[model samples]
Target: MAEPREIPEGPAHERVTVVLITWQRREEALVAVRRLLELPERPRVIVLDNASTDGTAQALREAHPRDSAGGRRLDVVVLPENQGAVARNTGVASATTPYVAFCDDDTWWDPGSLERAADLFDADERIAVLTARILVEPGGVEDGIVTELRESPVQGAPGLPGPALGSFLAGASVVRRSAFLQVGGFSRRLWLGGEEELLAADLAAAGWELCYVEDLQIHHQASVLRESTRRRRNGIRNTLWFTWLRRPLPAATRRTRDLLRSLPPDRTSALGVLDAVAGLPWLVRERKVLPPHAEARFAALEESQRTSKSRNYSR
Candidate 1:
């Protein structure tokens, strides 16, 4: 690991604050915080420790005992219980900066990338979300989803950094704090896996632009301690709820059928479907179809989503 360097206090450094959520991953979270503090931008960081029994909160406090070199504080909020992805909502609420970048326990933004992201937000007032090119750690290879983001079929409007996107990767994205709050953060109902899609859709519906910026980078070292099967289950259930909540009747039906067809014949898939069915009443009550333009963008991505290797539910 590189030694922590002093960061200059400036407008760029003050533009964004990072919000990371972790559960039980104490060592990984500490390592991530160290790398984040070492960034040249030296943005403020807040870690939401979701009631980890592993002393993650204590480790984080010990790791960042003082403010960053840029004079921004590293704060930690230890929740009473595991709120899953909703823990990010608390972190975002605590942020004083205009932009909030989401990070997982196993991920960290690259040096200067937060500043670059802030520049993009400064350039475009309508850009609510800016997703970075994620490079997996160790080999530093581009994430499989990076290809999908790069080849996004959505047409980009003038002045945006890269292609337009209908959805964003929360762990690798920076968002306007106000816009994020206005539309609400991640859904508590969706929990963690694949939670970004619902929030992204709501942002789009409110006329906020989401874009992919290749220059901004994030490093993700996927943690070994993960509940893959449970994650896949939640992801599938969330997808179903999102489809029913936002897509038109025909589109929703078609998507649900397609998803069912694609899922492997297993107990997990069956349980995911059952869980989705159990939520139908609530989903119906909250369902609001996307506008024509936003729906069209989602429609354009169906084929790509179906073919995406990164989105597979197989654990």
Candidate 2:
């Protein structure tokens, strides 16, 4: 593995680094990286390629060649195997900046947003994660999920930029590197879909605050190169795993029952349930219920989550 790139000096470089993960979406990844590089913040970016069969690694290298002076604006790490969301953890581990902004293959931060996020982190030491308002591409309309984030039922502290959040969307959030590492980053077992919740919960439990900042924005094109059914399956399975891993027995049982009732009676749903059940032994061994304060925050968001249009399991 290459050594983590040094955060370039001078006012030209932002104190934030972008950590993007891509798998098989080579074209989208290139577009995202190009857009990120065009930002005024000039943030250093690390791309973690999860063993793409396509020429994503070579394409990235060609697009952002290392400078002959031994300085680079971009660094690409091509893993031998796909590690799913854990690839972001690897990218975060390789970040030298105080803050890391995560973007998916089809997402890019809006210009000046990274600078604003860095300023927010600098202003509040307790703030660990700041989720940006996501706008879909083409027409640049606000994503449905942004409404829930903006109207968060969870209460905010005095210094937060917006409403406090019980969880954050990993694809559009900037996080304090130290706090993320302290919480051990994303869970390897959960892999990819809906993986941010467990880490967000742990951060809250550790006394770090997460908030939604309307001024900051991320653009997501929602790549067509995706496995919708597989994503839905993993998402359902991971949600169950997380509920069992962190919620109290009563909450977990209720959430589990609700999930089962809501899921479609199909092969994908069956497989997800099977996968979740297979992980019960590990969940039983590692279960640590959230603190009352954090649990209350989660409880407040339950209604919103249940009614969310952006969180549907269907393709």
Predicted model with the maximum TM-score: 2
RMSD of each: 5.6, 3.9
- Backbone atom clashes (below 3 Å) for every candidate: 0, 0
lDDT per residue, candidate 1, 1-315, as tens digits? 112223333565588999999999999999998998888887788999999999998877876676456443688899999999999999989988888999999999988888888877776777889999999989899998999999999865677889999898899999988899988898999988888889988888888889999999999999999998998899899999999999999989888878888899999998988999999899989999999878877898888877778776766
Per-residue lDDT tens digits of candidate 2, residues 1-315? Answer: 112334434442457999999999888999999999999999898999999999998999898887889788999999989999999999989988889999999999999898888877777777889999999998899999998899999975676888999999999999989899989999999888889989988988888889999999999898888888888999999999999998888888888877787788999999999999999899989999999877877778777767777875754
The list of candidate 1 runs beyond 4 A from truth reads 1-10, 67-72
Each prediction's Cα lDDT score? 0.87, 0.87
The estimated TM-scores of all candidates read 0.94, 0.95
Clashes of 2: 0
- Residue 264, candidate 1: how far off, in angstroms? 0.7
**What shift in Å separates residue 194 of candidate 2 from its native position after superposition?**
0.7
Candidate 2 regions off by >4 Å? 1-14
